[model samples]
Every structure is written in structure tokens, then in C-alpha cells.
Target: MTSTARILIVEDEPKLVELLTLYLEAAGYACHAVYDGNHVDEALTSFKPDLMLLDLMLPGKDGLTICKELRQHSQLPVIMVTAKVEEIDRLLGLELGADDYLCKPYSPREVVARVKAVLRRYQPQAPAAASTTSGVHIDETRFLAQLDGVTLDLTPVEFRLFALMTHSPGQVFSRDQLLTLIYDDHRIVTDRTVDSHIKNLRKKLEAVRPEQEVIRSIYGVGYKFEEGSV
Candidate 1:
């Protein structure tokens, strides 16, 4: 069994914070709860949580600011909790480096599941023997994607999605499959989410290499990375 992971909960509401803490601890994970934005930096440095559950509206500093700040220093996974239903808010959080977001009135069990899923994706481990010889170079160390001297500045999600496709080029992945790969809790995602990310990834790739498109969209199925060429 995997060891218990450390988590930090940053929600201002005493009742909700306490509830989540209780649920997470019951799940056999180490958890720290903070009720203000002022303590976030200190908690991040000292607690060193594997993942953070941040609420958007907080006293002192807002969650978006904290998310942006954390991204500058660490790739520690973050899941934003917000009561806001605006799509703009959701897009802003994701664009600012949050791995996921949970709307208000969420189940503690669902939150726990999301946490586990995110950790599974972002946590690093020793590479498998076969992966080393797969001829697909995904340099986690450099946060870079390269093929025949071409390089791209892929977002964390984009990089992961690209790596998945490139590892087995020509293998088509349905929208549902891509959603599962990109999000820890696929239960909260939609097919349009996959479409948006793919569009973003394509735009980023096109910025770097104007002549080529590495990802291709199928009319009725999904997407596949073009194979047989660099």
C-alpha cells in the first residue's frame, strides 16, 4: 500500500475546514488546516504538503494570488475551492496553474478522492526500465519537450497530455480517456474540458513550430499524435 500523503487545507470557514480535516484524517492521511491567507506562506514552507486545498475567497490574500505565488516556486499540486460559478473564474484558476477546482457544497469524500487522483499524477517516482528505452524523451527535470531539436513551452497539463500521446504515437485517445489522464477526479470534468486543453496545446505548439501540428482531431472519435514523423 502507498504511504499516507501530507495535505494542507486552506479554507477560512471554521466549520467547513474542520469537517474536511476530520474526513481527511479518517482516511489515514496527515492534514493541516489553516483559516487565513496570511498563514499560507508559512504553512507551505513548513508543512510541505503534497497537495493543497485552497478556498478562493479568503481573508488577507485571495486564493488566486496564493496559487500564482506557489506556482512560481513549486509544482506542488493545488486544487481550488470556489463558490463562484463563472466560467471565467474557472478558466482563470486553471490558467494560473491550479490543477483542479471544486465548487462549493462538495462532499468530503469527493474531495478526498480528488486529492488522491491529483497526487497519483503529479507525484514523482523512479522511472521504469522500459520507459528509459522508449525513445520518447520526456525530461521531467527540465520541464521541456523536444523532438529533433524542436522545443515547446507546454503547460503542466499540456506537457502531461503530450507525453501520454507521444509515448505511444498513433494511438488514438477518446475525449473521456484524455479527461481521465489530465484530471485526478474525472467525475467533475466534461468533454469540452478536453477540447479546450487540446486547443490550448495546439496553439502553444503552433507558436513554436508554425509548419507542423503534432496533434490531430478525429471527426467523430477523438485525438491522436501524428506518428512516423518528428
Candidate 2:
């Protein structure tokens, strides 16, 4: 885990924010707190948090709106906190790019655990050497991916997906196959989950190279890394 990772706590409840800060700080994470959604933008610019703990209901702006706006340009991890247990609310949070969420009346320790899980998914592990495939070079031991010598900020799932596809470029893989490869824990997930990750991965890659289509869709089949694109 990244000991220096900063966590921004955006909750109107002072007691809740205090509790969260205590737990996170004890876990070796830096914590910043904001009581209103209106201050989130300024806090983001000043604190430069690695993740955000956002509340659905806030004084100034709603968490959903903040999350939606944040996703426009940044992939900064966000874990939503809300009292609402509705399915639509959950789906909306996911659609707005929240990495995870905690329902109200949740344990503080559970919050810490969720934060750790999300960070683990994005934090790069130390890999000993780098391997080059096609135009992209991935250092598996270091958990790094580089496209045309530029680093790609891939989440763990994205890295695994890219690594698997690069292992045999041009080989088409079904969504089921990709899903199984990406997740070893056997967690229940839908095809849409796989598609969402793929979409995010494509966007991150395209940000660096707008013209290159590194990962190609196989129509009804699935997807494949374009060979010789490097």
C-alpha cells in the first residue's frame, strides 16, 4: 500500500469525518476533510488527493454532481458514502465513476478496508524488469505500462487485461475469457463490468495516442490487441 497516499473526506457530518480521519490516519494514509461539496474543487486543487470519500448529500453540491464533474478529466479514485440504499443510487454512483461505496451505518474499519482495496487496485507494485510487446512495454514486476515510452496510468484490472492481450497480440478474446483472466477471486460480475473497464482502458490509452487503436474490438467475439501497432 502507498503510505503517502492522500484521502480526501467530503462529508457534511463533522463527527463522521472525524471518525474517518482517525481510522485512515491510523492506517498510514493522509487525510483531508471538507464539510461542504462547494469546497471540494478547491480542496482537490490544493490537497491533490489520491482518493475521495464523497457523501451523496452535501450542503452546496451533491456528491453525484461532484463525481460526474471529476470524471470529466481525472480518474482519481472516488468511494461514495451515502445513506440511500436504492439500486438506482448505486448504479448512478457507479456510472459517475465511483470506485466503490459504503452505505450509511457502515463500520469505520470497513471503510478503511474498502479504501485499502481500491488503492490496491490502482497502486503499482514493484516489478523487477520490464517487457515490451507490440508498441507497449509493461514491467509486470513493477506494475508499469508504457505506450511509445510514455507511462499509462492503468488500474490493476486494466494492467491485467493489457498484459493478457499483449501476451498474444491479435488473438481475440471473449468477454467471459477476459473477465476470468482479470479477476482471479471468482467474484460475481457481469459483462457490463468487463465492458466498463475496457472502455476506461481505451480512454486512458487514447489520451496518450489519439490515432492509435491499440485494443481492437472483434465485433461479436470480443477484443484483441492490434499486432504491429508498436
Best by TM-score: 1
User: Per-residue CA lDDT of candidate 2, range 38-76, in tens?
Assistant: 999999999999999999899999998998898777878
Scored by lDDT, model 1 comes in at 0.78
Per-model TM values vs. the true structure: 0.85, 0.61
lDDT of 2 at 203: 88
Question: 72-144 in candidate 1: lDDT tens per residue?
Answer: 7677888888886574345643566677778888899999898888877765666533323123467765566
Which residue ranges in model 1 land beyond 4 Å of their true spot?
92-94, 128-136, 140-144, 147-153, 184-188
For candidate 1, what is the TM-score?
A: 0.85
Q: What is the C-alpha lDDT of each candidate?
A: 0.78, 0.80
